[model samples]
Every structure is written in C-alpha cells, then in structure tokens.
Target: MSCWKYWPEIEEIAETLEGLGAENIDHIDELNKIDIEEVKKQLDRIEVIAHDKDIDFDSAKHILDNERMNKALKLIRKFYLYIGARLETENAQEIIDSDLDPDEILNKFHFYERYEGLLENESKLAKFNENKTFVFIGSGPLPLTLIMFRKKFGCKCIGIEIQPEVAELSRKIIDKLGLSDGIEIIVGDETTIEDLDYDILMVAAFAEPKERVFANVWERVTPKTPVLVRTYSGMRAILYAPLTDKQLRGFHKEIMLLPIGNTNNTSVLLRKIE
Candidate 1:
C-alpha cells in the first residue's frame, strides 16, 4: 500500500505531537487537521500522544518546530520500538513502556502483514530444512517465510520477531506442524548485541531495524558466508542495501520478484564471499 511508503510522513506527524505535549492542546486543531484513515496512521498519532506521558512537556514543545531534529527523533523512537518489539516477540514479553496498548500495536502490525500479501499456503514451506541454520528477521507476517524456508530447505531457523503474540503463534504453528525440531527464535535489540552469523538472513519489508541489522551483519561476516534477504515489494536491494558486483561475495546475488497470489514479493539474495 502507498501508506507503507508514506510511513515517514506519518512518523513526522507523530513528532509534531511529541513536541506538543499531552496538556498543550492550544494548537490541537492544527494537529486534528490530519485525517485518521487506517490503523497505521492512527498508531502514528497514538505514538506521539503516548510520548507526551514521559517526555518533558517544555522540551517536547521546544523541539516541535525543528523539522530535522523531529525527524531524527522519530527515527530513534521507531528504532526503539523495533528493538522492543523484537524482544517482546522473541521472549514473549512486552519490553517497551508506552501508554499505547501492546495488543493494539500488534494488531496493527498483523493488519499490515495481511494487507501486504505475505504467506497463504503450507506448500510454500517446501524449501525449509531441519539441518542447516537460518535466521528470519522482522517477523511482520513473513515468519511464514521462515516456516517455509525451514520446511523446504530442511534448515534450522531462528526467527527474530517484533511482536510477542506473533512470535508465539509462529512457534506454536511450527510445533503443531511437527517442525519445532529445527526452529529457534530470538528477539534482537538494535542498539546492542554483535551480529550472529547464519547461513542466511531473511528480511521482510517495513522492517527498518532489520534492514540496518542486515547491513551490520554484512560488515562483520567473512566473504564466504551467504545472506539471502526477502522483501515484500519495491526495488528492495536498490532502496536498502545495494551490493555491487565487485562487493558481492563468491556465493551469488539474486533479485527475485516472486508471485504469491495476487501480490508479489521482491527479494534479494546476497551470498557471503569465501
């Protein structure tokens, strides 16, 4: 959806609210001018309102007019949320302190996954394996990919999730399907932890933190390791981590736009160089 691309704008609006403070409603009309359409947009608004609860009121308003500073602040907040969600999903506990309900946020994330045309069938898991190791980042509905990758590829997997319920559900599904032997899921914090090596790192769209994580992994891995990333749509690798032919590892780099149903997932495969 176009909303995915315009998430930055929504985040900017949230920064405005962050600057406005909870009690500062003098300009509430100006803020109310923005239309409330989907859950994603509403969540952005809620995130800003939630910020007023903890942030100093005066400091929040002081930075209101500073567009650049606000933008940066939103990114930082976004990253924090990503880290918290990953922890919550992996550990099955909520880590972030926020006025916004974790259930509400998770629901919106699920809505995004449903709308993005992610996974639908079991056969897609044909490539998964229980022997080899793999990691799935940003479990925004693409954990289905992990399920399939594990089944089809016969590889062991660790799913790095941002929502506890989602992660739990994925784990349950794996168990129900009798595929638990190969999957080990964890929550990743962006600000901490060194990169963990894996045969592949499967990423999904709308995962800003995971995108950065991939770049971090690339910087650390030896030339022989391979990283296969998955994107929902758009010029994936080009927009995020573009690897040059010279920079590519000896393994291989592939750009694939696979059709799931009515939608398509554009994924880039970057193998490590040995």
Candidate 2:
C-alpha cells in the first residue's frame, strides 16, 4: 500500500500520463518511451502533494493502496530510474576518466549527506551486530555503505559489484582510505555471495529486479540471517521501486521499517524465516 495522500494531485498526474498515450502505465517499456522531463514534472507535482500538511497519513495510505494508483506510481518510478541510471552512467564514466581524488568524488555523491544522518541514528544502528560481517549487494563505484558500516560498527564488510571497473575503483578507494583490512571488494553479483560468509546482507537502493534477488538470497542464505533491503517510501516511491508483499513470502512477518534520515528512503529489515 502507498503512504501518500493527495488523490487529486495523483489523479492529475495519471491523467497527464494517459493523455500522453500511455496505454498501460505499469509497462516499463511504454513509460521509457515517454519524455523523461515530462514524467519528472509530474513526479515533482506528486511530491508536493505528498508533503502537503492537509493530507493525513491514513488518507494517503488509502489512496496508495488503490490498484490503479499503484500502477501509475510504478510507471513513474520506472521512468525516474531510467533517467537516473542514464545520468549516473555518464557521471561515472567522466569520474573514472578523470584524475580527481576518489575521496573528493565520494564526498560529492548526492546521498552522502543523507547517509551520514542515517549512520548516526542509534536506534537503527542497534539492529545490526557490530561484531559480525556484512555483504553489500550492488556496491557501486564508491561503496559508501560499506565504508560507513565499517567505520560505525567496526565490522568487516564485503562489497559485491557487477561492473569490473567499479569494483576495481572501489578497491582503490578502500586501499586509499587504508580500510583494506576491514573491507573486500568483489566483482560480481548475487553469484559471489556463495563464496563468502557474512552475518548480514544489505540490498543496495538501486538494485534492479529486487524480487528475484530476494528469492535468490532466501535460497542461498542460512535461516534467521538478517537481510536489510533498502527501498523508497512516500514521495520517493515515484523515483524508486519498493518491494511488494509478493516478494516477501519467505520472510518473517515481524518486519521492521527504518527510515533513512528525513528522506523518502527506508530500510526494510527482515529475517529468513524458512
């Protein structure tokens, strides 16, 4: 269910998409064909409605639960991800080709400030075992999450990246920071998980086809192992796909949802119940 209010605003955005010739908003291919800027404008308006003070939490949740609205939100999120990935790819290529310090590049990442706030939250920090190891899936060029986890928890970390160049660059950054002893950067995806041992699994925010990954993790990891799935909530839901109930089948029902700072990003904590 959605946690967003302002049905009128959402309806307007849906109408706009439909007007643009979107036969099925839930289809990613159709959404990708639409002009990104137009989609972004609609998303911006939806965000404003999400933050409106007059919209109560219960009402927003009810609107979000509507099937049609949910499909529209999913399409918007796909467009957002498409645009973001294109931009990120361009930026990563430029950074990799430049002589800029890795530290400086890491500092300039958009999510750096938000992550700092999240790392400082004691209640959320308590959820992880400080003495255990962690493996972060989809660890990108910077591996900031692994860096933060190591610094804050004093725990060992292993980052899995699909891109060889990104994995190499992340390793260089880790070595530059003298954190090589505490963290290891591996170049691969979920397949690499089998060769390593970790106490916790952290799913990166931009991880694609999360349902499949969650199922793979469930089958691979030991029972009761904690899995932290990072997802978007509230207004951010339009920019990132959140996990659906169908994808959570093998997990315990007693789940915990922790918001990261004041952002629409949240960490869904679950244990392998099967």
Model 2 scores a TM of 0.71
Query: What TM-score does model 1 achieve against the real structure?
Result: 0.43
User: Over 4 Å off in model 1, which ranges?
Assistant: 1-130, 140-142, 162-166, 190-197, 232-253, 258-261, 272-274
lDDT over C-alpha atoms for residue 91 of model 2: 44
Q: For residue 171, give model 2's deviation from the true position in Å.
A: 3.2
Q: Give one digit per residue, the lDDT tens place, for model 2 in 1-274.
A: 3344355666678678667656644565665567766866776676566555454446555665678677776655655555555444434455556577756765676556767765554226335556788888998876777888888778888999898977887777787767899999998887679889888887787876677877887788887677777665554555565677787778863455545444555666677875
Q: List ranges where model 2 is wrong by over 4 Å.
A: 1-47, 50-57, 61-72, 83-105, 120-130, 176-178, 253-255, 258-261
Index of the highest-lDDT prediction? 2
The alpha-carbon lDDT assigned to residue 1 of candidate 2 equals 36
